[model samples]
Target: MMRVVPLQSSGVRGHDNANVDFVRESFDSEAFGIEIGRIRAAYATSAAGYRLLFKSVLQRARAEHFQQVLRRTRLENLEEVWALEATGFEMMDVVVTFARSVAPAAALPVWPDLRVEEATDETFEVIAHERAAAFFVGIMEDRPAGYVTCVLHDHTGEGEIELVGTLPEFRGRRVATRIIERALPWFAERCRVVTVRTQATNIAAANLYERVGFTLRCTEATFRANVATALRAQP
Candidate 1:
């Protein structure tokens, strides 16, 4: 079973394969690049007995993907830690944090070249309308950058940066920070703390969060991939 929740609020599905095809193709590409080699075994259990198959591609791919992520988001050469007041527990920082790397694996095709768009897009408006705040679309140059879908609840008392992204072509230019800078005022009014959560394996993201005054509340192990000699084995 597969599902996709856009902006984490609504689940969007389609009968046609084209929609899912884009997603599946991206997944296969990412899996092949990072996790394809890790498949060890596959098995299924039933009331009658157990069956094992040597096709743990999904599992292996996940493991390998995460391992690479862990390596990239490593805490190295961290220099400073800054903080911004969003509300109470909600805070923003611009130090060495890793919130930049928590995006879905499908976006990996354009990884590193990504940048955030602070302008409003179609997706941002959908979320902002429900939350009653203005939606902003993050942009990189003339192209449409990543979009952040979020709003302030309870007035300015609670603010959420639901989705922030940096497209593959515009990364490494501090575009996420540009988005953060634009949204701080909304956060400062009501929320005690401004918070963003992402994958722990995303070192760039973690560093970005830290730089923006966010603290590491917790780290969870999610999303795994497999690595095999055929996949990651040295040529």
Candidate 2:
């Protein structure tokens, strides 16, 4: 199953009003199914307008049998958040982005006998599935302790820390921090800024980023719904 969610329009404008639309597409080759949905966020001041928007979106989702529909609103968009929640698409996640300058780092305190290295082709196959532009691995006693993937945006001169993971056994040893700290200078050399996004629900990850100099930039409320559940709830 593959799902694609793309923004159709940043926001649509009318005489004195604006709205945002996102289109989500999902395909399951095995099931031979394709689902498409449109999620709209309207800038409206009245409750009736919000209700009408939700009703239309829900009706369209049901008609198309979309397995999942998502509507994301800025944290400050309380009205949209309330309207989306009222429609049964509960807030599932809070996505937060953090940014920091690319500066040379003071040497990270070495974990005893631990070293970080560029991921080899063999390790990349197992760890990153070859999706990373660059991959680094932290090795402890010749075992993979943690890894981070860097994706560069040449046009923007920005690099994103795409994925970070530490082996369960190495969780409390600051392996994630080591991998990130190790990767930053590499990115700094190639890009002007480095950014990462993670779920706000991940307190540990958020704390780690903060301790590493990343500051909270913004957060969005993510909503999710299942078609089956929506159907079950309707008359």
Candidate 3:
């Protein structure tokens, strides 16, 4: 399975008939602050598979302006790890996803210094469109302190806290926590499970999510390659 979620249809499924594949991640680019690509092995192969695929990756990156290419694989997949590194990819980080059912209380909290606002203006429109997601924003001191986006995959009834962040100065104020809390009732009503992911090295982040009732579900290693420099090196 492709570790990176299918953000868009990108790249040839099998280039040069190698046992590997790639897709450009349009959504992750916004999340990571860099243009990104995701690669995966269709089946186990030697380093040469990744080597041959790198050429296609470069072509796609060149055409689409990708800054980095990433591959997510299990930590135990030594063969894939070796192939990726041999192809110039470097270990980036370990990503861990946490999951839990966020049961809602009779009444969601009424924040004194915050408000839960819809992600879009569709809520106020004359006719509402079917929504697959919602953005819960946190208003602090009359400003946008932070926000958490929860996506409901109706097909599977799985909810994901797609993204969460708070201003640097708001770090210790429970901004992220309250932002997430504000989304729980919205999620609990529509999803069987709510999940969030973060760097395994970010103990503080992990602790925060756990406090919000999320528990570790899975972990994967992220590898990256800076193809822009390689592109500059090319003729």
Superior by lDDT: candidate 1 or candidate 2: 2
For model 3, residues 15-38, the per-residue Cα lDDT tens digits are: 445555666665667667888877
Query: Candidate 2's residue-wise lDDT over 113-133, tens digit each?
Result: 679887657647544544456
Better of 1 and 3 by TM-score: 3
lDDT of each: 0.38, 0.69, 0.71
Once fitted onto the true fold, the runs of candidate 3 whose alpha carbons sit more than 4 angstroms away are: 1-6, 10-21, 28-35, 40-42, 45-67, 103-106, 121-132, 152-157, 227-235
Q: Backbone clashes per model, in order? A: 73, 0, 0
Best-first order by TM-score: 3, 2, 1
The sequence of per-residue lDDT tens digits that candidate 1 reaches over residues 95-170 is 2222222212222122244444344455544444444354445655556665554445442344566566778776
The candidate 2 region of ten consecutive residues with least summed lDDT is 1-10
Task: Tell me the TM-score of each prediction against the true structure.
Answer: 0.39, 0.66, 0.68
In model 1, how many backbone clashes occur? 73
Candidate 3, residue 222: the lDDT equals: 90
